[model samples]
Target: MSQTNIPLLSLKNISKQFFGSTVLENINFDLYPGEVHAIFGQNGAGKSTLIQIVTGDIQPSSGKIILNNEELKIHSVHKARELGISAVFQEFSLVPQLTVEENLFLGSNNTKGFFLDKKKLHQMACQTMEQLEFSIKPEEKIINLSHAEKRMVEIAKAFHTKPSIMVLDEPTASLAENETNQLFSMIEILKKEGIGVIYITHRMKEIYKISNRITILQDGHVVNTDSVSNINEQKLVELATGRNITNLFPEIKKQRGKKLLDIKNLHISNSFIEDVSINVKAGEVIGITGLAGSGKSAIGRACFGVNKIEAGTISYLDDVIFDSSKQINDISPRAMLDRGMLYLPSDRRAEGLIMEQNIRENISLPSLGLPKFSNGFIVNRKIEKDIVEKIGE
Candidate 1:
């Protein structure tokens, strides 16, 4: 499709439902050549459902999906890819057992009829990684890579598909600023190649920075679609939330309470972090700000037992406490949770959420074993739904 002609992809009056509850209602949208289109919405607003339908992961109950003026029969995800559609899901779909090169060339590896062509696959993988300026060995196993490295590998894998349309679901959630910039550069490269991109994110700054157009979804319906130039940040937030987006960090209403957390001389090996010290007072909102690799997140992990600390002492007031002599590394995630410390990871889909689980289970998972529900060792089901409904709102 020409840049000035009809859109490369179009969706007219799309709708979806589950068990009589409508998730997406009469939604319409379009994607044009060389344009970065963004879809913004809160959780459960059908943004995922729309992506699923477009990528053939799910079928829409009603609507017409036209690509290049031809109606598409998106029966399955594999079928979508066959039609030059690719998605880097919010959830990591990578097979960690495989090498980075193998993950990159999973299905499209050059094969000699019945046999596999390993050499050509590795060559193509290396070339693609080099193009992204990602420093990682093609032969390295995915389990050996850090979170950022794994995210980079996923992007490399997406590129190997040679897609006409690529959907990135929160691509920058785990990426550093430099890595995000690199991805943006790659997106520009794709745009020049006439490929359409659908970027899904909650970060308004990203929509302002990279997207050419924006489509906002709320309560499973389309609110509006317009050029980025036509709307400002406040307007965009209103569209996404149906209300003015409040300052996420609100003012303190009361005096800071007793010290709830304290860390002294924290360090992690080989990572760009060392000798970090911080404290969190009861009912206090503490913000950690720094450039990537500056130990901002590493500190969070060390406190929650996700990463090992070479030396540190954490005192969580009377509720919980830790000493450097004890192996904080030995502290289990359950132990941390038991002590009233919960972590909301930056990568919500990959680390913070279980997409396969329904909305109810995910919200209730943290408190699953609590004594509130107990009848012959089986938890009461009624209370679970109540808890979920409260959180879902």
Candidate 2:
């Protein structure tokens, strides 16, 4: 290769292990200037582990990370940022209580003086958001912003660093189509500025549209790495999953059981879900989709009792769970869960799991008070362990 062909960053024989189990093995990858290199894989295929190692969130068991032809011993996230590497992970890192401007410069050296220069910081944040064409107020609290807005803020924070290497892990997972397009445009701008981008996503269309090269990981190993033009979508999926994906989508079965949930003239005043009526069958897999502010999420939240219904009625089988006419409060989340209703929030870190807790503890937390896992007060260790194991399997 010529001097101009040298990779901006290269991973040489990278491998990672947790406890005694291997998570990544001898993974060799290259990210060249002005190109998008995508890492594609199924869940647990080590894509996240690889990115974490590069970002200095986790240490690799073996291998070297070379940036600008110099070997780097990345020990912490701050060190990686100092080395001109920035990343926007799948999970949002913004503090919910903080304003957009605060979150943008949270740990950055941009904040000067004993007290934060709020005026200057706000101006800088507005400029950054404008550059990305994101229409969000810098003074708005992160908790009040929509999921897509938060994702844009995360991207803005990473872009503000002006890094030579930018890593985006599933950046568009929560974004609407227009927001995704905006992000793609920003990536193009970064490429024009000679920034090497590492895009980790499972979306095949994205790889074909924006990536220069594609690297597939399977079972902790690099299955293949090739130019996007050299491989088709089916081949890429096969490589990631380690099996032939004959159908891009599974066949849609029309069979549906009795109506399990019925919402009639539902109106959630706070969320703007107005007079929406929906029926869900027992065996149906329903998809509710719309633009960013279209009240799709509110429906799910109201159904699961997270958002209160202002009017209308919600019936589950023979029972009227919620009826605004009767002025009854919505059923609690615990009551819904007991009745086999589960809600997987989009913000998994805040709503789903306890980051400080281990996997076993997080998994067993909701079931601790159940009779099967506990004897009214004391938890049966064996039962809890078995439940966790079963759920993991």
Which number leads on lDDT?
2
Quote the lDDT for 140 in model 2. 95
Model 1 C-alpha lDDT per residue in residues 58-113, reported as the tens digit of each score: 89999999988898788998888888888987667788899999888877747978
- Residue-pair clashes per candidate, as listed? 0, 0
Once superposed on the true structure, which residue ranges of model 2 sit more than 4 Å away at CA? 1-3, 110-127, 130-144, 326-330
The lowest-lDDT stretch of 10 consecutive residues in candidate 2 is 107-116
**Cα distance off (Å), candidate 1, residue 303:** 2.8
Q: lDDT for every model? A: 0.82, 0.88
Candidate 1: misplaced stretches above 4 Å? 130-135, 244-254, 267-274, 290-294, 305-310, 318-320, 325-335, 346-393
In TM-score terms, which candidate is top? 2
lDDT per residue (tens digit) for residues 88-143 in model 2: 99888899999999999997666466778888999999999887777899999999
